[model samples]
Target chain A: MSVRQTATAVRGRYQPRISLWWWLTKPSYLLFVLRELSSVFIAWFIVFLLLFVRAVYQGEGQYERFLDFAANPFVVFVNLVALAFVLLHTVTWFVLTPQALPLHLRGRRVPGGLIIASQYVGWLVVSAFVFWLVVGW
Target chain B: MRRRRPVEPLVWLLFSGGGVVTAILVPVLLVLLGLAFPLGWIDPPPYEHIHAVLGHWIARIVLLGLCVLGFVHWAHRFRYTLHEGLKLQRLDAQISLLCYGLALIGSVWAVYILLFTG
Candidate 1:
């Protein structure tokens, strides 16, 4: 029960647990966990998408109802969650992307950092274009 | 220690590339369609015109390839990270199989949507 002994014991018995407290307090940890929670957003989006499909099969009134359901504050909160999910998803996805997409053009070792940065840059350009269109056009 | 072939790493690369490309291409195309379609600044040419941008054969192949690869990437990375990083266990294989399985099914579904629907 001494401190070192306790540390050893905890490490020895580590049981597939990440600290809930740590996850709560740690910004990146919470972000990563929140990214995982993004499945909720995915599910909500899909359910509504399914509703749209159903409405298409049904008629305009059902589609309007679908729109109505979509406009609720709860739905807006859900979208906000989805946006946060996407942010975490994108950043983490790119950061880890190094492990996934190790492409090389001339037998050079492509740095993961470069890959991730490029991906984000590409996203930024595309997003800027979208913003430009949304605002200007 | 034996240096095992880095199969997982290579697979990760494919996953990353596909994910990145799709991640970039999709939103841009969508936005362009949204803005340009309405204002006549950016128009998606006729399906016939646009379809050939990615040749018929290439488009289908790439789409299926991307869908399958991206999901597999998600599966392998997520499972391994959960197991090693967060120290989660007991469900690694289950999660991996489930995610990858969805990817496979999704690939087939996408193929059907593209080829048969069109």
Candidate 2:
């Protein structure tokens, strides 16, 4: 009705909309969020292990039941989601690891992919040790 | 019960080591735990035995340390992500209101789980 009311209405009508990909406004930010999300998965995976340990402490029967609970369909779905997060974390770490620990080998900046591969290789070595510990074969 | 600081160098060492351990353990643990679910691999982790391995005081310590480190890392990462990603900054004061609120909640969760669990 009044001029002020008309201006307010015009501004409301012209409010911006949020697009799905609009989050890409800051690629770094997106990467950061992905980093957080990935870490959350990493956290959850740890929690699951902790639960496993707790169940074991309770005794064999408790352990079996807890293990079953963890393996439920809901958990499987959660694990799948975590799998997606692992992929996100792996990619993000590769992309940003270089930044976190910028290495210069022989007076040249090492490649990011190379850095990531090196970490993967290192992880494989650790995994082998765990495999040995757990399976002992 | 309301401690905000991480434990110590021992804890930090445990944290660093834990990530590598998780990468190694999760798949195997998954396979081992899979027996409970029909969809899991036929060869599972022999639940009771693995539980025996994990149920020690030492195991609990390791898990708690790892969870705290992982959560702290996640919170710090998310803070920057929100500030940078989505350009939530473009919006008015009300938008940042929720973002800050979430950060507080995340911090509280991290502190609560880490301090009280152990």
Candidate 3:
């Protein structure tokens, strides 16, 4: 191998050291970080739902106990925070969806705003359906 | 020659599917079940109602989709978060294993609970 080729191969790209709290530097960065962090809470919500379902499966007594647990101040606080993060996740997910799944009609691409607005419409419809199933129905 | 298909697009499909499902369903569920029902802001549904709803095949399928896709979504995002946000790419293999491993376990647990328990 040529000496220049050997030198180039030996020296890799320079990567600047980044701090762990780099996301804190700007509002947008923080928002991005929070959106990423929302995944953890999403996982938490799944676990919460599983436990609730299991409690329901076990019967009335267990279900009541689960409700009591959920009603605890700490659990309620955690859930409130989780709700915030998940809301952020929903907003960011929908906004970004336009980029990931661009829709086309005829020959032209669909407007991003239209896609995002449709997502909100879908969210409302889905939420209403769930409300009907869980409470209204 | 037949080219080998990459697993990434499938993973991203699960991720996006999960994102859309959870985005639409979770917030209201959280408000109703997590907050309102527990706090008595709204009357809790009858245990029979909840039980009956969950017992239905459709509810089971929706829930299974939610849990399975949700975890896959979480796995993909959290994996990228560690790699990019925290700059932990050096531990890529281990990180991928840990994130996706937990997702797998969570999905299995959801399946078991959905199938066997309730």
C-alpha positional error of residue A96 in candidate 1 after TM-score superposition, expressed in Å: 6.0
Ranking by lDDT: 3, 2, 1
**Candidate 1: CAPRI quality band:** incorrect
| lDDT of each residue in A50-94, candidate 1, tens digit only | 343344334456545654565576765656556555455566667
Which of the CAPRI classes, incorrect, acceptable, medium or high, describes model 3? medium
Model 3, span B26-87: residue lDDT tens: 89989987899888899888899999998898998899999999999999999999987977
- What ranges in model 3 sit over 4 Å off? A1-13, B1-5
| Lowest summed lDDT window (length 10), candidate 2 chain A | A128-137
Which residue pairs collide in model 2, if any?
B32-B44, B32-B45
Please provide, for model 1 over B25-117, each residue's C-alpha lDDT reduced to its tens digit, 9 standing for 90 to 100. 434433343233433455334433433433366555654564555455555555555654465444655766776676566556555544454
Could you give candidate 2's per-residue lDDT for residues B1-117 as a string of tens digits? Answer: 112355445434543454344444454444344332336444445654454545455645555555555544444444445544554544524543553454346445544543344
Candidate 2 regions with alpha-carbon error over 4 angstroms:
A1-21, A24-35, A105-113, A135-137, B1-38, B55-62, B81-118
Residue B90's lDDT within candidate 2 is 42
After superposition, which runs of candidate 1 have C-alpha atoms over 4 Å from their true positions? A1-21, A36-80, A92-121, A124-137, B1-7, B26-62, B77-88
Model 2 reproduced share of reference interface contacts: 0.27
Cα deviation of B77, candidate 2, in Å: 2.6
Each prediction's total of clashing residue pairs, residues at least 3 apart in sequence or on different chains, is 5, 2, 0
